[model samples]
Target: MINQSVNEGKTAAIISHFWIIGLIIAFIMNMSKKNYFSSFYIRQMIGLNALQFLNGWIVYKFLGGTAGWIVGVLLFVLWIISLFGAIKSEEKLVPVVGEQFQNWFKNF
Candidate 1:
């Protein structure tokens, strides 16, 4: 039973990294099961999604040049790394603001 719960949590964790929709689904899944693993990934994904949104606005609207593209690439790389971590069922904090994200979204 413990192993089954862990597997479920890992599955939810991995799914949470897909995108905003996946994040919501994972959030709901975790709510039902209350899995710490899924919660960790959910918080990270929330932070990542918020960052991506802000980055998009700043880059496209304010920057609108090579700088915007560069930021987009960097965000993509971060997303990939976070997704990989989730897939591996590891609580690897993302670079830079990962720890901050965990603290900020602790209630989630």
Candidate 2:
């Protein structure tokens, strides 16, 4: 069986969710091997970032700092779990949006 663990170059996937810099790193890493999770995870991270970006308008825009803090913390936790799973070579999805990401970006 193919080792499911993210390999040497695959580390990019786990780090992609940290911030935009991580996304750039992932992009560079994936430039040579497009089929790797490094690429797919980067795409997923971008999607997640976009979602969070839009979240500010939906909840934080009116609820203010308190709601933003709650939502931000929740997103951070999910990001950590997904990053850890990816690093450990597991295909576990990130709760509600995990499966959707995989399906939406299947072509990647």
Candidate 3:
């Protein structure tokens, strides 16, 4: 049973990184089961998605140029790292803001 939950959690974690919709689905899925691993990744992905949205908005509204592209690439890299960590079933942090994200979203 524990192994099954872990497997489900891992699957949820991986799915959560797919995109905004995936994150929402995974969040709903985790709410019922409350798997720690899934919740952790869900929070991380939520933070990433929020950052991406904010960056896009700022770049479109103000910093319209190569700066936006650069930030987009950096965010993509961070997303990839988080996705790989989920694939490996590891609780690796997402980089600079990862720990803070975990702390902030602990209730999830």
CA lDDT scores, all candidates in order: 0.85, 0.73, 0.88
Residue pairs with clashing backbones, model 1: none
Instruction: Give a tens-digit lDDT track for model 2, residues 29-61.
Output: 777766465766776787677668866777688
Residue 62 displacement in candidate 3 (angstroms): 1.3
lDDT, candidate 3, 1-108, per-residue tens: 766666779988999998988998898888877998899899899889988998889985698868888888999999999999988878879999999999888888
Point out the worst 10-residue segment of candidate 3 by lDDT.
Answer: 1-10
* Consecutive 10-residue window with the lowest summed lDDT within model 2: 1-10
What C-alpha lDDT, on a 0 to 100 scale, does residue 77 get in candidate 1?
A: 88
Assess candidate 1 and give its TM-score to the true structure: 0.89
Deviation of model 1 at 57, angstroms: 1.3
TM-scores, all models, native as reference: 0.89, 0.79, 0.91
User: Model 1: which ten-residue window has the lowest total lDDT?
Assistant: 1-10
Query: Judged by TM-score, which candidate is best?
Result: 3
Higher lDDT: candidate 2 or 3? 3
Residues 29-78, model 1: lDDT tens digits: 88866998889889998998898888888877887768878887888888
